[model samples]
Each structure stands twice: as structure tokens, then as C-alpha cells.
Target: MEKTVMIDGKQVQFKSNGATPLKYKMQFRKDFFAEILKLHKLGKLKNLDEIDDDVLGTLDFEVFYNIAWTFAKTADSSLPDPETWLESFNEFPIFDFISELQEMIMANIQSKKK
Candidate 1:
């Protein structure tokens, strides 16, 4: 699956495909599915104030950026490293956009049964 979202007035394309997981693992040196599951805890919360400090303390917020970058990289092979790519954007409204990515991530993992 592919999506184009506007960030800081620029159109950014993100892709999730057969190679997405592998790209994520290779770039971040972390299991894509495992990292994704970590975000599930945040998804269950009614608000940030409701977070359990014990869990929030250990959460790597960078995972959010890494996941976004991985999908962006998958869409455009020539994109620079994550940091540089992110720097190009004046504002990256990740919180607003992550939910969209969550759906794409889920679709990537689902299998079509005939």
C-alpha cells in the first residue's frame, strides 16, 4: 500500500509492501513487527495523561520516526537517511499522521484469503 500525505507543504509518499518489513529491519536493526506492537500500548490510552509512567518511561519515541522514515524510504529509494530527511520538513505532525500509518501497517500484515 502507498499513501501521499502533505507535511510542511511538501507531498511525502510512504509505501508498505513485501519489502517494507525487511527495509525497516535493515535500517533500524529492529524487528518491524515487534516495534509496531510497542506502539499498541499508546493506542490503548484515552489520553497521554493516562499513560502509565512505568511503560512510558521505557518507550522509545524514536520508533515513531523510524517507522515513518522506513515507509518513506520504501516509497522513494533515493531518500537520504532519516535524520536528514526529517530535517527537510519544518514541521512533522507525527501524532496527527501516525494513526494513518497504523492502518497501513495493519494492512501490510493482513493476508487475503481466497
Candidate 2:
């Protein structure tokens, strides 16, 4: 899956594919699926408002940045290291777009049942 989202007034590209998890593991040194499981509740919520404060409080928020950067890096190889790339942006509203990123992640892992 591929998408372009606006961040800090710039259009940034992101992609998720078979290699995305490998790339994430290489870059972040953490298992992609494990990190994703941390946010599993978000996957089931219909909206941010549906998230309980207790659940939100328990989430490892850094995973959001890691996953976002991984997808961004996968889409554009020339993007600098994650921190530097993120520094270039004045703001990155990960919450505003995490659902989209999660969809891409889920698509890469889910299989169709027939």
C-alpha cells in the first residue's frame, strides 16, 4: 500500500510492503509486529474518541513514530535517518493519521479468506 499525507505543510509519501517489516526491524531494532500489537486496540476503534484514557495511557506512543518513519523510509529510500527526517518536519500529527498507517500495516499482514 502507498499513500501521500501532508505533514508540516509538506506532502510526504509512505508505503507498506513485504519488506516493510524487515526495514522497520533493521531501522528500529524492534519487531514490527510486536510494536503493532501494542496498538492493537486502536485497530478496533472506530474513532479516536472511542479510545479510553486508560488504554491511551498504556500505549507505547513511540511506536507510532517508528511505524510512520518506517513507512516513509520504505517509500523514499533517500530519506535521511528517522530522527533527522522527523526533525525536518516542524510537526507530525501522528494521531491524526495513525489509522491510515495502521490500515497499510494490517493490509500487509492480513490474508484474504475465501
Which candidate gets the maximum TM-score versus the true structure? 2
Q: What is residue 88's positional error in candidate 1, in angstroms?
A: 0.8
Clashes (backbone N, CA, C under 3 Å), per candidate, total 0, 0
The deviation in Å at residue 90 for candidate 2 is 1.1
- Model 1 misplacement above 4 A: 45-55, 111-114
User: Taking the tens digit of each residue's C-alpha lDDT, what string does model 1 give over 22-77?
Assistant: 99988989999888877776555555566687868866778889988999998999
Worst 10 residues of 1 by lDDT: 42-51
Model 1 alpha-carbon miss at residue 27, Å: 1.0
CA lDDT scores, all candidates in order: 0.83, 0.84
Give me the overall lDDT of model 2: 0.84
Stretches of model 2 off by over 4 angstroms after superposition: 44-52
Residue 95, model 1: Cα distance from true site in angstroms: 1.1
